[model samples]
Target: MYLNSIQLQDPNHYMQIAQSSLLPMLKGALYYTLPLTLITFSIGLILALLTALAKISSIKPLQWIARFYVSIIRGTPLLVQLYIIFYGLPSIHITINPFPAAVIGFSLNVGAYASEIIRAAILSIPKGQWEAGYSINMNYSQILRRIILPQAVRVSIPPLSNTFISLVKDTSLASLILVTEMFRKAQEIAATTYEFLLLYSEAALIYWIICFILSIIQQKLEGRFDKYVSH
Candidate 1:
């Protein structure tokens, strides 16, 4: 039954089946793909900012803790991390629903990676800027908020945007955790129709198109930022 008699008789029928299946898969992307990316990226950005600040803090304990956190997250495979959160957490009487578990796992992973990008951006600023703030009798917090971070954000935009583009792809991993994302829908369809390659390739194509559009937006943002910096 894997080979439909009709499709076998006329191979062009395979194209028809592929086209028919594509719309539903696209709808799956609209419902789950964008929402997952937006929520995960939003929460992840906050965590990344806090973690980056802790990494750069003068307090030794904070620096050590942040380093430990980033190392643990970055060293492990993301799938293993998802399993630890979703499947392992129940052992400790910490039970969370699957959606939240996926979000938490993805956010933590993104935080670790994005924190490094932000920290590097912060470091790239001239040391003289910090000294000037101190010379003006401004505190570290004031200098960071008013002087350092503002400039660093402009520099961070390109890398941070790339991180987000990557996050959009990573959300497919959520399907393994039972989040019903686009890839999950494709798997379900493939199981029923026994057309794994076609459905999976369609899913990949959709992901590619989504990322391509995001890359365009990223270029526009970079152009505007470049103009602003040049001014």
Candidate 2:
């Protein structure tokens, strides 16, 4: 009888509920998720470019270190990576809040993956371009900066943007460490209202909307870059 006895006393309380917490939760989610995606992606991009250069360098130590970093980061799951940042840090007495931990972890993981993409793009450049740079008496760094990297960046943009888009969705994993992003907000709302379906569905809808906008941005960026590549 208790199960059947459950009912909305006001019958329209959810309309009231929507006004009170739901709107704020959506706003909180956006504030965290967008910044998380942008900051992590920017950090990861700079790191990837540097690491990819090291990977291709003739310097043995740099090549080895680059290989090692990529192997270790790629071998682990990002969830475990986050746990190491949030939980493992305290064992050595180093501590950070959930947001910074998530940023560091996500950026490092994305950096490792993006390094491979960058390395591949750079390598795809024709050998003749480097030869032409050498013929012009250009040093390795000059050749890379002037002739190779710009083309590689154009090739890399599509994949890098896609990686960042994936990172946006991944930010929800921050909830495990108590970062109050979208999924965490949904869980909180569900707990308070016992309307798990409605609350979570609304949260999912918000995420989809954000991702849809990012998709539009991605399409425009790809189109812009594609114009240069088209024969």
- Separate clash counts for every candidate: 0, 0
TM-score, each model? 0.92, 0.90
Q: Residue 96's C-alpha lDDT in candidate 2?
A: 90
Model 1's TM-score against the true structure = 0.92
Error of 2 at 103 (Å): 1.0
Report residue 9 deviation for candidate 1 (angstroms).
5.5
For model 1, residues 146-212, the per-residue Cα lDDT tens digits are 9999889899999999999998899889889888888998898899888898889989999999999
Misplaced by over 4 Å in model 2 are 1-19
Candidate 2 per-residue C-alpha lDDT over 88-176 given as tens digits, one digit per residue, 9 for 90 to 100: 98999999999999999999999999999999999999999999999989999999999999999898888888898799889989989
Which RMSD does model 2 reach against the true structure? Answer: 2.3
Deviation of model 1 at 79, angstroms: 0.4
Taken over the whole model, the C-alpha lDDT of each candidate is 0.89, 0.87
Model 2: lDDT equals: 0.87
